[model samples]
Target: MSHSIEITPIDDQCPLLHQTKKDNIEEAGKINGQYTNKSANHIIDEKLKDLDKYTSKKFIAIFKVNVGLRKSNPDAYTPMLISIGPYHKKNPQLGSMEKYKLMYLRRFLQRKRGLDVEHCITEIEKLKGIALKCYDDIENLDNDIVDKFSEILLLDGCFVVEFIRECSGMKPNREDKIISTNCMINLVLRDLLLLENQLPFFVLTKLQYMTKEVDEVPITKLVKETFFSILPKMAHASYLEREGDVKCIKHLLQLVHMSSHPSYYNSLWHVQDLSLKIISKDQDYQTWHANMPNVTELCEAGVRFSKVGNTYSDLEDRTTLFDIKFENGRMRMPCFEVDDVTETLLRNLIAYEQQTCDVLPKHFSDFAVFMDYLID
Candidate 1:
């Protein structure tokens, strides 16, 4: 097994030491104190350089300590070998869907081999006790702040339901598979109440961009400028299939549609950093994405999801094995078929699409002419 410096009987305890050592991150924070816009970029750049130096130094120190420890006791390193690969997140953007789906499948199977969907899906459920304050606030009334809290609920809930619905029907080869990233992401969002406090906007921003960056850049800062507030509204569209929620969904969408977003593109620093990522991680990603066979490449990595017991058969007829509240409020099957649900949902969506088509032409003569041409 490979050895490192951090394992040596150090002056610090391992876990606490690990956390303490992490204070010297390779990624830099935004420099405090005001500066002109031009100077801000340069300042950010210099800080990033310093952060990288600190991170490298820490890595060297840790390596030296670990190598010394392995020489002392090789048995200790074995546990670490089992912990290989990233536990949280490794990269920023979720790469090509095909590769991610395959990777997800592999991980799932490895983690939960031979587990049926019923047993596998159980971890996603069960009580993880709520924030008592957040829970209590929801139980009894606060008339004055009810509107604000309600607004948050509407935003958060809508984002989740729609994301699930939109992603509920993914499969490989069909070009209509569930996005594994979306599923994992949504679960993480739900588990926030279970795991952490209600995720603040900045934390949410960090989670999106928190993949280890090339120069040890913490994405949370960039995420501050990168996020679209209206992103929360996409959830409303998803739960449209659920009953009695149509008007609420429409109102949420209307707010999103009317909103203006902050100019985040300027804060982005892709000029060099993005390239560093592309050169590094993209090679592995490109290799995986390119490996797809033309025939089966586009499907949900053939559903052979390692962890979730998903197979092409599992995804057959477009079904996924989510413990979802079906449109009728009953629990959908542990492994429900997708095509049946989509045909029904798509029919309603298409009908709505037609109504939209009918109405949009009144405001746009070009649209009216285009509709006429299509009918002709």
Candidate 2:
């Protein structure tokens, strides 16, 4: 007896499989159609709705050091002793300075005589919105955030004002531990110059005007002297003594940058067109050449180095660090001493110019690029 078994095709046996696939395809088509039919104008309108909430005034000047740069040298960018602004205010390592800030605040109030602590809080509150706007990462800080921020501004601003006053020889508080010790003062100065450690210039100016006597040295002069005194010997000589009043400085680091290149800050030297000048319009491309060798290679090529005898005052009008002169096969350049503070100072200056964009010229950035090319 022979028996035969019949096998049906999968599709024929299971008709629902085809229907399920067809349903899936139709649903996918509907989703794709919805995406494709979105009009450009409608999409733009939806985007514009978010723009109003994020449309900020250009109050943000200070910025955290970018990750790329910070990765190589984290210590250069981080504050060790104290935090000045909202960015690093919560670091546990810097908590010790908070008490000193309060102490400075009390002294500041004493200097003002009748000005109560509430008055300081109120004044800071008035500018709290504007001050908060000065930071880029304060989006989460709502109007209710004003109270905490106001307290920070009050304490930090008073600390800075008092420190500057003491540094400038206004009156020394012998009992104060921070300003009294030379090492502590130096550390504080370094911390204050960090890129993230900054307060708005106007805030410090307001505090200075409120507390300072009519006959006292202006805050600008005091700041200039204090900063110059703390910098290394080479940077001290590099400072170009300004004749007139100081320009509107944004922070202590800005003051350092301006002091280093006064002509550029004072508008005496405008941004030079750094582009290679075209000799003729007919020339499609300009030939560029730079053979900057290392000191060893340059020595082998019969080049000699000599210290530039010209003082900072002698070359006050020049705007670049590349103020070199080649005479008799010897390259004469200004002497610059690089010490512990040099790296931190330079990194902050470059960070400032990088973030400020249109607010200040990119002198430091240009210098860094120039140096990189030479090193390469």
Best by TM-score: 2
TM-score on alpha carbons, each prediction: 0.16, 0.74
Q: On residues 1-376, what C-alpha lDDT tens digit does candidate 1 reach at each position?
A: 9977756565553343245445433231223233555667887999887664232221110011134333544332221101111111122332232243344433333333374334322422221111112222222335343334432332333233223223333122343433446445433322221111122232122222222224433222222112221122112222221233222222111212222111122332221232223233444533432232221321233312122223233112222222112122121222323431222222222222233323221212222222233233
lDDT of 2 by residue, 1-376 (tens): 9999997786575343244675365445455563323454577889899766652747576677888778878899898898998888768999999999988888888886689998988888887777777777666445544458888888999999889887877764555544688778878888888888998877888888888797987777777777764443323334646535543666777777766653234443221222122112233323322433445665776878786533432333342343444556675555555667767877887787777766455656655654564356
Candidate 2 runs further than 4 Å off: 1-48, 55-57, 140-147, 172-178, 232-247, 262-291, 309-323, 359-361, 370-376
- lDDT comparing candidate 1 with the true structure: 0.27
Error of 2 at 331 (Å): 1.5
Worst 10 residues of 2 by lDDT: 270-279
All models, RMSD in angstroms: 28.5, 9.3
Question: Candidate 2: TM-score?
Answer: 0.74
Q: Choose the strongest candidate by lDDT.
A: 2
lDDT score at residue 191, model 1, on the 0-100 scale = 25
